[model samples]
Target: MALSCGIDFGTSNSSVAIVKDGTVGLVPVEGDHVTTPSAIFFQRPNNTVYFGREAVQMFFDRAGGRFMRSLKRVLGTPLMTQGTLVNTRHMQFGKIIAAFLQNLKTQTDVFAQHDVLNVVMGRPVHFVDNDAEADRRAQEELKAIAQSVGFRNVEFQFEPIAAAFAHEVNIQGEKLAIVADLGGGTSDFTVIRLSNRYLRKADRAADILASTGVRIGGNDFDKDLSLSIIMPEIGYRSTYGEKHLEVPLHTFHQLAEWSKVNFTYTPKVIMQTRQILHQSHDRKRYKRLLQVLEQETGHTLLGAAEQAKISLTGQAEHRAAFGFIEDDFFVNIQRREFDDAIQYEVDKITASATQCLNQASVRREDIDLVILTGGTTEVPLVQEEFRRMFPKAAIADENKLSSVGLGLAYDSQNKFGDGQP
Candidate 1:
């Protein structure tokens, strides 16, 4: 029998799955987690680029314009601008995706079992009608990329539809499900109805009556956190000459971007900051003074900020320490304050949900289940907001994260039979 695979090329993370012996299993990448980070890093030293975790780690590796993380946003947009020089960074988006797909293919065992690989990829429904001409061109470009990556048969299904299919397989009922897929760069919601008899007999096809999306997710949250907490405490002067004493806010912003994912060790970060400050003062004798201040102020402040965000999810109040910079550098942030930080974005999400419901002519009570996906949904405020909106409906099982890829794998196995010889 032939082997088939399903790929979830998500904006934040990507995963591949295959079915064997009538069961779906996620394909592990390099003995690590099943999902790969959706990042790319260009290394000038070797004139090569890296993808996945390696790329994410090298995000701030002193390479000039060598990192691109959110290229998915421009999938359907034109790559060229009048009078602008184009480089490898300006290469077509589809080709970049194809490169990632190629890397993924090389990592998995899917190619050995089947002479012709059949792949089902998840795409957002919003792309289907994005300015007809541009949308068609984008779809064509994506399809061509798949073909280039060696997939003989490539199929695209709306992401929410795939999530619904995944949800339907696990729960046996005749009811409506709301899928909230909050990925890295975008969040989409879709309402779907499922019936076991309908699915088993292929008599009823699941319908996506309404769908909506916003180009906001976890990355936005990280940015907001950096702005509200880290920037102020760093003593990063924005209004000054371009000297050691006068660092640009933009430079700190770039540093914050790097610090978000890197700089796991607090002491290392403190020491690094102290070194920078000492250099700024132009006095080698003050190096120890800078180190003492950093240890007593800077590290504590940043660490507390991150911890507060994490604690606010489960606790009503959280205090972030900032003693590294000053004696009274502490900042007390209540859960409410954290929620307020993301209030506007949460409102947007709620509004999007309402619009989807209205478009489908379905009331909140009509939704039988709500499936929450992505990391942002883990936020307490987001969870509370969604729960209030869907109090009556059961939040679909939390396992929906990998459900789409699993369903695709199951569908592939059924379509192609077992992989056994």
Candidate 2:
């Protein structure tokens, strides 16, 4: 017997599902939670590792080690081949990905009472937008990682299309639906025709209209909030020297990036910051910057921005604190300011969704339903954009985090049945 399973290795969160005898199911990868945060923490001295919510909590609990989030965003880039020192040994990123996948596979094994081999993995529509070769390489690399982790066979499904499948099972009549899956690392869209007529069809190519995506996502919003409201207090725009020349801002930008934050503590960059600190006209701001680097608090500082972004999802203002940087350090962020900061990213996401419709020769009013998934859709500004576009279309209630995984289970059932390979 074979276990046909699906894995949505998302940017911010992840889930696993299986199709058994036409029934879909999930195993609690962490405690009672089917979905776990896509985070990893490595505890020092022993190099012991933790994943998901536990990893994040350990990170904030002052546990000694390295923390990494948004690992999915690094897949299509050069960093996928790079390595970082976990303890005394350098660990390649490909191995890191395998480790995470292996953990999930272990859970799948226990759920099946045997080794589960046939699997499907979800991928964003555009892993690296506008770069076809790079996109192909990214998919190949991911497939290799899954294979390395003991999967006998692996297949890929576009995330938004997978989400579309999850919605297709619920609708009755024929409808032109748009699926917008905005995750922590990318925003993806799919224009498709959904109906019960095609519910069990294995090939959805003729039903799907168009698929498009861009790399801007929730992490970008976190970065913008960090740079605009949090970085200034840490010498981002402060001046130095008799000329009062502005201090270099590249390091602050790096700190704002989830994938590059660790690079901020490199000896070369730290030395450069100190050289400028000596000439700072105002040492207070630069001192705070130094403190962040010395403590390797890049993730903690950005966590404040992320929390503020969530807090402002419904309110007008949020005061984010960075006591980790200094005692009583707080920054008040207005909703308008947060919206203004992310205006560029918002516009890009809007344009990508428009591109999908245009590619399919579909119009706003032509759509019958708008299926929204992924956590970033919770933001007020992002919600408003969709409302204005598909004013006449009804919004489908989506699972946000696990829809793709659930849909992929259906896909797995279609591609690989109940028999052993």
Candidate 3:
């Protein structure tokens, strides 16, 4: 049997799927989860490398500068200064990404079974329009890395297009559909015409009305929650009694990273805050008790605040304790408050969707289906916004999220014909 694989190298999480026996399915990781954490950690003292969940778990333990996450957003950007080093403090962007992909490859089941793998990966459409040069360079680098890892051929597909193909299997007739992919690092939209089961077969099907993206997703919301709810309770300030509050800033960033990893529920971020305070006050033993109180109070306040937000998605109101350190530091956040926190992002998504509809010269009623992909779509506020924005169209199957990788895998096999020798 020939082996071909499709990979969704997403900003927040990554997954690989394979086509076998004419059926496309997800390739399970060593631990049985189809999705792998999109994290990379470079460890010192032993020169060890970590990827996926293991890397994410080790993030807080490692120095922030040494552990890298969300480099996918930096793709097609100058966010990484030229010649800048990653963990080990001496490698450039190219090397860092290569290492991450290489580690991802090793974690895949196909690599173990196939002598030569045919791989198809997904990229955002904005990567083409906004940063063509950087996008092209990144593609070349990815291809080189895949080839080096024993892949016979590698190709890239627009993420929304890949997602649309996944959706095409179930839906039929001459119809227009909207794909709203709200991933961890970015959100993308694609409006396409689907007739029969084929995509891009004729000039009409090949037409792309509008595609737009923004660098906002679940991580951004977590940051907003942390800033508005947690930091203040911890007595955190940019200036803390003469010394710059650099440690609290670092702690806040760390909590954002932590939020991305542990998305299932609000994590107990108190320990992380404690570690920060301990390190920050290491020089002054007399201030240790105060630092501990600040850390505890901050975590309690932030933890309750985040829980409330998470809860408000399912409940109208959620009550949480905010003042473990100071009795007066309690705060209550209603569903409306959480909604207000994310209103800016909600507006951006709606505007993008409206612009896309206008660019397509299609009325909201013309859209036959809407597919919601990405973790952010799980938020009730986002769902309600999309529903309000596109009331005429029925949302496409919620089951489409897992199928993106499957379609990409099938496409890989069809496009490359099993990586024949």
Candidate 4:
């Protein structure tokens, strides 16, 4: 028997799903966890690779090696073709991504007794916002990568549209839905009519009214929050030298950004941070920054920021611990501060959602349903934006983290379930 699955290679987390018989189901990518963090950690000595939670855990445990997350954000950028050091060996970003996907396939093969091949990968509406050429290249590169990983038949569906299909699984009648997939790397929106009547139809192009996305998501929020709160503590935008001029900000930006953290571990960056530490007004802050650079704890620092952002979703305040950066030193981040920090990103996401509806020429009131997908939607501010737009629409967050993968599986069933594998 042949096994086909849908791969949602997300920025913050990833999932794999398959359609067995007529029912769509999720694959346990991480020891029974349907979803796994999109992270990779390379252990030292042998440079063996680990994925998902284990990867994150190994990195945090100071298990000597390289750690990387948010690899999906590199697609469509020149960095996709660039090489970086994974331990002592240099590896291209594309290969790192392929290793991750290959792991997904290997795990699937284990589940299916070594019978898996065809795949439908879920992608954002726009991988590189505002640049058609880069976006096209991104999909091309991804397709090639997927094929390299033993996916004999590969296809793609816009993530928001995929979320719509997942929502359609338990829906009734007809609904004019605005599917908002606020993921880690990007936030995508689609205005589409969802109905059980069209489930069997292979072509949903007619039902898709509009699709639009912005290159902003949970990771961006993490960056903003880190810059606003955490980075400043670690000498970001701090003054140095005789003129009291602010220190160069290039290093700090990369340090706080989840995708760019590992890039800051170069020898050049370490020396640069050391030079900045020399003229520091307050040696303590830059001192820690230098330590972070030298110790290669940039990822851990950014993870603290990401955790702080997630904690703010359910609580009014969170203490962003930086004990790794220092001894028992942490910052109290209030919800209001987080909201203020990420206001710009939230506004841009809202604008994109409105733009999607405009591209469809559909009035906001007509969207009777708002299907929310991806972990970013759990944020209070992000959710509030969609609610403000579609006040009357029913908001559904069924399986926010796994909807895209599950929907892609349904899509695969339609596209590949013709009679034979």
Q: Top lDDT: which candidate number?
A: 4
Candidate 2 global TM-score: 0.97
Across 20-105, the per-residue lDDT of candidate 2 in tens digits comes to 76677776778889999988888998878899998999999989888888888778688887777775568888888888888889
lDDT of 4 by residue, 254-334 (tens): 987787887887898888778878889989998999989888888888888889988999999998888877898989999
For model 1, residues 1-421, the per-residue Cα lDDT tens digits are 5466778777667777876665667777535678787677657655377888787556434343255554554566655111111123345556667778787776655434444377777766554333767666656777777789887777776666666667676676588878887765667788878655444333234366888876666655655565565454455552222454553344344433322222222466556555455445333323323443333322233334546766877898876654444456555667776777778878887787888899889999899999887666878888888999999998865654566676566556555665553
Q: Per-residue alpha-carbon lDDT of model 3 for 153-241, expressed as tens digits?
A: 78877676667777777766766888888876677788987654564342333556777666677666666665665444444443332
Q: What is the lDDT of candidate 2?
A: 0.88
As a TM-score, model 4 comes out at 0.97
- Name model 3 segments beyond 4 Å from true: 59-66, 79-89, 109-112, 127-141, 199-207, 235-312, 316-333, 418-421
lDDT of 3: 0.63
Point out where model 4 deviates above 4 Å: 418-421
C-alpha lDDT (0 to 100) for residue 312 of candidate 4: 92
TM-scores for all predictions = 0.72, 0.97, 0.75, 0.97
Ranking by lDDT: 4, 2, 3, 1
Q: Which 10 residues in a row give candidate 2 its minimum summed lDDT?
A: 412-421
Q: What lDDT score belongs to each candidate, Candidate 1 first?
A: 0.62, 0.88, 0.63, 0.89
State the TM-score for model 1.
0.72
